[model samples]
Target: MTPSSSSEKSFNDWYEDEHIPLLSGVPGWLDSGRYRLTISTTSHAPSYVALHRWTDLAAFDTAEYKTATNTAWRTTVMEKVVKKERFLLQYKGELCNILDTLL
Candidate 1:
């Protein structure tokens, strides 16, 4: 997600101090991390990315997850996001094992 320049600090603060902590308390939420895009080739790429891991897709349907996402601070911060995207990917087997089988 990319926040407008004026809202960058607020976005960062909300994400770090509030959002992550709240989500971390949810059941089946394994871990999460945030990253900045430093070398994207696309001109309009979002400035930030957040990766979250869960035990299963059911975690997203939980009350805790819903509560964590529906906060006033998240609403305010999200309003300033110019672009955002979300994807849920299932984990395949290890890369090394796959590569060895191919070789």
Candidate 2:
């Protein structure tokens, strides 16, 4: 999430304290985590990424999840500060190669 300095504090506060908690209530939602990139080829790369884990994509269709994401704060941040990109993925489980380098 890219937030202007003025909105940064509120945005981060709301995301961490409110947004995630709300989304976590969805039926298939397992976890939600955020990260900031420490390395990038250019500034245009996303500064932050949010990873939301769910049992399946069907979780997104729930009314609770939809309502939670359609709030005023989300609209404000999306319109004025952050441009979000979403990627739907499947977890392949842990890497278990016995001889793989630990690098």
Candidate 3:
């Protein structure tokens, strides 16, 4: 997530304080986290990343989650951001080992 400098404060506040909490109540949403990249070769690369965990794809099929995300505030935040990326991923085997190797 790379928010415009002007909207950075608003984006962070809405995402951390409101948006994430709202999404948590949706069915099959396991958890979520936000992070910033410590190292990057390109200065224009995304500075932040948000990881949202779900039980399965069925989680995203729910109307509740869809409705929650399709709000005015969400739209406003998205429009203000410069760049962002979303990934839907599943947990494979032995993530702890992979993390150890990478770190």
Candidate 4:
């Protein structure tokens, strides 16, 4: 997601309101993380990374994330502000220990 260098308001809104909530809603969506790059270095500008985990490869493949994101963007209150393109990514692994809990 690229925006004009002068567009601070757009960036804040996109992150806080749109991108975070929309991506968080996908089925089996585990997590999405954001990082502000080079926190103490001379390069003060921020760059973000998103981390996503799914239930499994097959489940992710059928999740229809892009379609759902587009539908929400076009049909909800989110439509008023966000303008970022989503790029889908996938990986394969036999995931283990999805959760641990104690009662």
Candidate 5:
């Protein structure tokens, strides 16, 4: 997500204080983290990214999830976002563990 320069602070505050906490309460939501882009190969890359892990896709369809996403603060913050992207990825299998081999 790329928030407008004018709304950067508001976006950070709302996302960290409100959004993450709310989503964390939803069942099957395992963990979440937010990161700022320090380096990127493409200029079009967003300034920020958030990753969320869930036990299953069904967690997203729950009433709690909807309530967390549909909020006044979210609406306000989103208006300031110039670019955003979302993806739901499924875990396949771990390819290799270097640490295991080393041990």
Candidate 6:
């Protein structure tokens, strides 16, 4: 999701306040963390990347993923303000250093 810095940080902070300790309570989900990537000033607009990592495939397939979701404000914001979508696909080969964890 593309979010302005202020909105992005606000959403993340709100989510952390709402989730955090709660996410660890959700079964099958472990080591959940949020990460932000630096923006490229050369681009037309400043941007940031948000990363959410689940323990493993099973963690993602489990009930936690279904029952635990975005906070109300975030949900409303996405529903009202954000109007873009992308489908994620799992493929061979590492997309980035994310695999470094396993290595």
* Top-scoring candidate (TM-score): 5
Would you list the clashing residue pairs of candidate 3? none
User: What is the per-residue lDDT of model 5 for residues 14-97, given as tens digits with 9 covering 90 to 100?
Assistant: 998999999999999999988999998998999999999998889989999999999999999999999989887998766578
Candidate ranking under lDDT, highest first, comes to: 5, 1, 3, 2, 4, 6
What is candidate 1's lDDT per residue for 1-103, written digit by digit as tens?
Answer: 9999999999999999999999999999999999999998897888999999988888889999999999999999999999998888988665467767888
Name the lDDT value of residue 1 in candidate 3.
84
Q: What is the TM-score of each candidate against the true structure?
A: 0.86, 0.78, 0.81, 0.49, 0.88, 0.49
Sorted on TM-score, highest at the top, how do the candidates line up?
A: 5, 1, 3, 2, 6, 4
Q: Which parts of model 1 have CA positions greater than 4 angstroms off?
A: 92-103
TM-score of 1: 0.86
Clashing pairs in 6: none
lDDT of 3 by residue, 12-77 (tens): 888987789889988998898889888998987797888888877887778889887888888888
lDDT of 2 by residue, 1-103 (tens): 6676677777788788779989988899889889877898887766678888888778889998998799888777766575556678887777577777664
**C-alpha root-mean-square deviation, each candidate:** 3.2, 3.7, 4.1, 6.8, 2.0, 5.7
Which 10 successive residues of model 1 have the least lDDT summed? 92-101
Superior by lDDT: candidate 1 or candidate 3: 1
What lDDT does each candidate get?
Answer: 0.92, 0.80, 0.84, 0.54, 0.93, 0.53
> What is the C-alpha local distance difference test score of candidate 4?
0.54
Misplaced by over 4 Å in model 6 are 4-6, 41-46, 80-103
Model 2 TM-score is: 0.78
Clashes of each: 0, 0, 0, 0, 0, 0
Mark the regions of model 4 whose C-alpha exceeds 4 Å error after superposition: 39-46, 58-64, 71-103
Best by lDDT: 5
